[model samples]
Structures are given as C-alpha cells and as structure tokens.
Target: MNDTAYTELVMVREFKVSPEKLFDAWIDPVMMRKWLMSMEATNKSASSDPRVGGLWEIIDVRGGKEYRAVGRYLEIDRPIKLVFTFQMPQFSEFEDTITVNIKATEEGCKMVFTQHIRVPVEENWTDEDTRRAVEEFHDSSQHGWHYMFVGLKMLAEEGITPVMPPASE
Candidate 1:
C-alpha cells in the first residue's frame, strides 16, 4: 500500500472592513492577540514581524499542554497578500506553508487563506488521518480568523478597540 500524504485546505471569509485594516489586524501582534486568544481553553502568545523574511512565533497552551509554532514570512504585499511557513515545535519535521490574500471589493474585503501540508512518504500516512487533521485544522483556523475580523470590524466602525480577555482569566 502506498502511504504518501498531501492535502490543501482553503477557507475564505469576507470582512466588513477595508483591506488595509484587515491586513493590519492580521499582522499586528496586539490585534492578533485579541482574536487568537478567544478560546476559553487556550492561552496564546505571539511575536511577529510583518516584512518578508521576518520571523513569527505563536505559543498556545491548553490543559497544561503547550504547543509552539514557528514560521518565517516569505512574501508580504501590504493589504493584498502574505505568504509564510508554519511548523509546530513538536512536529518540526512537518512544515506547512500558508498564503493569505486580501482584496478590496465594493462591499468590503475578501480574505482567502490557504494552507498546504506536505507529509513525508515515510510517515505511513493514511487518508483517514490526513482528512481528520486537515478538517480540524481548517475549522480552527477559520474560527480564529473570523473572531479576529469581528473585533477588527468593531474597531473600524466604533473606533473602540475591544478588550481582550486576561491571560489568567
């Protein structure tokens, strides 16, 4: 039986804000923390530099377990496109790349995020495992982005930044 794995998950969302604002929220650490840390079970800390070749790291803690993701920016086109690599410390050998594209439209901004996973042939990869992992990742990614956009739209419209939950809370 062949045991090679490859898959891509794509999610698109429309935000009721300008592309510039949406892009800023994504790349800015302060704004990112607001939405990225919304989950009740998780604590997130991130450091990001938005230029090409810049570095980023996100640490998530849940149930006394920690997961760290490190990545480097590959391309940055302000308010339009961003490409970066994503890898988990525990799964360092498995590196994935994600591309985000934002476009201005008549109503708002259309944001598309695509994650590409490349699994080595030696992992004895199975279709069931791949599908489950991809589905879970895609769902979580979409939820986080949607939450962030909600906060962004609130800020853009009300001119008030939403309060983020306290880390210990």
Candidate 2:
C-alpha cells in the first residue's frame, strides 16, 4: 500500500431535501438498491450494516452479469458524514476509501463526496502511459459516480419510488 499512488476524486452536489433524508438514502438497503449501481445496471439489490466496522454490499446485473459494490463502514456520523471502504472485486483487487460529508443548507443539504483510489502503476510503463492509464480510470469512475448521483438527486427531489423486485421463493 505504501508504494501505491493514490488519486483523490471529489464531487459536490446540493439537494433539495433534508440532510437526514439525503443521508438515509445512502445507508438504507432499498434506497441503495435504487441508486448505488451504475445507470445501466438492473436487478439491483443491497444489504447493509451501517455501524462502524460493519460490512455492506450492493449487487447489480448488467448484460446478464453481476457487478458488486462492497464496503465496510469506518465512520458514521448520522446525517453529517460517512466514511467507508469501497471495493469492486470483479474489476480490481485494490480497495478505496470513500468519504461523504453532508451539511444542511437553507433550502436543503449539500454533500461532498470523495474517493481515495489506490492506483498502482507497473514499473515497466512509461510516464506517459501511466498518466493515461490513471486518467482513463478516473474518468470512467467519475462518469459512473455522476450517473449514480443523478439517481440520488432524482430520489431526493422527485421522490421517485423504486419498483422493488418480487420475493424469491
């Protein structure tokens, strides 16, 4: 981990909803199922343990294959802040830490989300190659996060009710 080059990705968004409502969208499994996965994902499901050190996971199907977002909670400060470890095992072996800070505003709330990514460069790669790789990785990740945030915003502002899947026998 010491040798890894960490990249920080930060995003901020304001919502027209109470801090508690916005924060609840992150920890509650049903809300997570609706907003945590990529926009193209389907059959999304989530399970959570929101206390510090508790593990949470969300799985979504895309093209008939599953992609997961798994994490362990590191900090939980109610409607104010949350810190967790985020991992996508199907994509990479490295883990990242995500911090989400929320503050109440006159109209609603503002959220600052940050992800610290552990980007490992191969020794044999040229500097230009390393730069390109990291940029591409971050770009894709940022795009995905933007999509998820759109869903969050919709959930907050429009109260879009998620159509939950039927119970499996």
Candidate 3:
C-alpha cells in the first residue's frame, strides 16, 4: 500500500472521426468486437451498458481457452468522457481504473486514455528482481496498448476491421 507500488499508463491518439463515433466504438459490443482484443483472439464478446454503474465484460476464446475482463462503469459523458473500473475475472486482487477523454476537433477528434494500476510489491520492496519484473510489466503494458489503439483508430476512422491473426498451431 505504498505509493511506490502504483503504475500509470497513458496514451493519446487522434482520429478522423468525431467524438461521438469514437465513443460509440468503445461501448458498443458489435463495433468493439471488430477491433478490440489481440489479433489472435477469437469468439470474442464485448458486452456493456454505456451508463454509470453498469457492468461490462469482454471474453475471448484462444486456443480453446477463454480469457475475460469484467468491469463496472463509473462515469459516462457522451462524446466527451468515460471512466470505469477494469479487472480480470480470475484475478480479483488486481484491478485498475481507466479513464478516457475525447475532445472534438475541426478535423476530427482526439482521445486521451489513462489507466492507473497498482502492483502488489512484497514487503522488501527494494529487491532487484522485483524491480526488474515491475519494469518489464510496464514496458509490455505500454507496448500492448499502443498496438491496440492503432487497431481502434483504423476501425473508427476507416471503417476497416483488421483481420484477426490465425490461432497458433
């Protein structure tokens, strides 16, 4: 519960679509499934109610395994902002808060996404291995989000659904 255990990841992207369209792509399962999740994820479902306190979940099937993220909405401001709690279904102890802000531009719209996550570091927080693991986790998290956001922009702006990568053999 020390301040040193928290992690914050932020990403911003501009799209050739309005805030409304970009926002809808986030809460509508039909549009979301077209872009969300890794390229290898299949049989995916993104169900959500775009209102405060409503629950949302994303489930994806990969190689006969199901992975899911379930969360509850905290705020919904159409075409502008949304805040929510995000968590993995199997990892009750690990949860994060995500906030997305959208602003309209003469050209299109801009989105700023922020996720604040807390990692549970053991009592000896100064250990080298633990520090390295945390660093690696942050790097991977940043990389993953950047990749996914590109897909989202493509879907929203171009109406192009990127093909899902084939499942591994």
Candidate 4:
C-alpha cells in the first residue's frame, strides 16, 4: 500500500500559571530542557532561537536511545500562539506541524496543543511486523507528548520537576 496519511493529535491542559509564564517555558531554553522532555527521558540539551524562522533542536536520551527533534519556528506571538515544524532525522520520512494556542483565564490559562504529523508507511514496506512497528511508534509519540504536558504543568504550577519513574510512585 502506497497509502499516505497525516494524523492530527490534540492535547489540552490547564496550568496554574499565567499564559505568559506557561508560554515562556516553551521558548526559554533553560526552562525548556527542564520540562519539555518525557519523564522516562533525560534531557541531553535544548537550544532554540525562539523567533519566527528560527530553528531549535532538543536531544533526549530515552530508554538509553538518543532521540532528537529538530524544528523551525513558523510563527510566534508571546502569551498567545506558537507554530512550528517538527522533524526527526531518524524518521526523515515523516514530518510534523505543531500549534500551541493559549487562552488566559481568571485563575490561570488553558492551552490547546495540536500536532499534525505524517504517518509513515514506506512504499513496499507492508508486512505484519512493519505495520505493528509503525503503529507502536505512533502511539509512543502520543504518550510522550501527553507525559511532557503533565511535566510542564507541574513545573509551572508547583515548581516541581518531574523526576524519572514518576515522583508519585
């Protein structure tokens, strides 16, 4: 199957901080490395220009495997919106676009994060094993982002850093 498809995933979460504070964490490299990674991963580094047309790269060591996400900022509006393109070098076959919109509330803020990603299915690579692997990768990415969202909320709200293996346990 030469089937090509792009999947969109949306994750919404509320933060106990202002929109500006929550948005800043995503652009500031210092705060980014602290919460933009999966709990199971240790951040190797996060560096970004954080302006329109600027590029960013985040390296994380997950499951003892190095995972790299490189992207460019397409749009930026402080405390409001941010749009970026995401790509994984190892999976150069796929591409992703991410949009983050923040709305300030009486207490804090609500963030609507959307990711539109190309679902990778290489031509002539259709087999039971290959199909399973592709599905697993998609699900893994979904969970990773949701986990990062929780970590971000904690960092912005209670100033608590998410330690590996989850602190609640």
Top TM-score hit: 2
What digit string (tens of lDDT, one per residue) describes model 4 on residues 100-144?
A: 999998889999999886765667765765667556766777787
What lDDT does candidate 3 reach at residue 151?
A: 75
RMSD values, in order shown: 5.0, 5.5, 3.7, 3.2
Error of 2 at 127 (Å): 1.4
Superposed Cα deviation of residue 104, candidate 3 (Å): 0.9
lDDT of 2 by residue, 19-48 (tens): 999999989987887778743237367989
Q: Give the TM-score of each candidate.
A: 0.71, 0.90, 0.86, 0.84
Native-to-model Cα distance after best TM-score fit, residue 163 in candidate 1, in Å: 8.8
TM-score attained by model 4: 0.84
Q: What's the TM for model 2?
A: 0.90
Please count the clashing residue pairs in each candidate, in the order shown: 0, 0, 0, 0
Indicate the residue-level lDDT of 84 in model 1: 90
Off by over 4 Å in 2: 1-3, 39-41, 161-169
The better-scoring model by TM-score among 1 and 3 is 3
User: 118, model 2: CA deviation in Å?
Assistant: 1.2
* Winner on TM-score (3 vs 4): 3
Which regions of candidate 4 are displaced past 4 Å? Answer: 1-3, 39-41, 124-138, 165-169
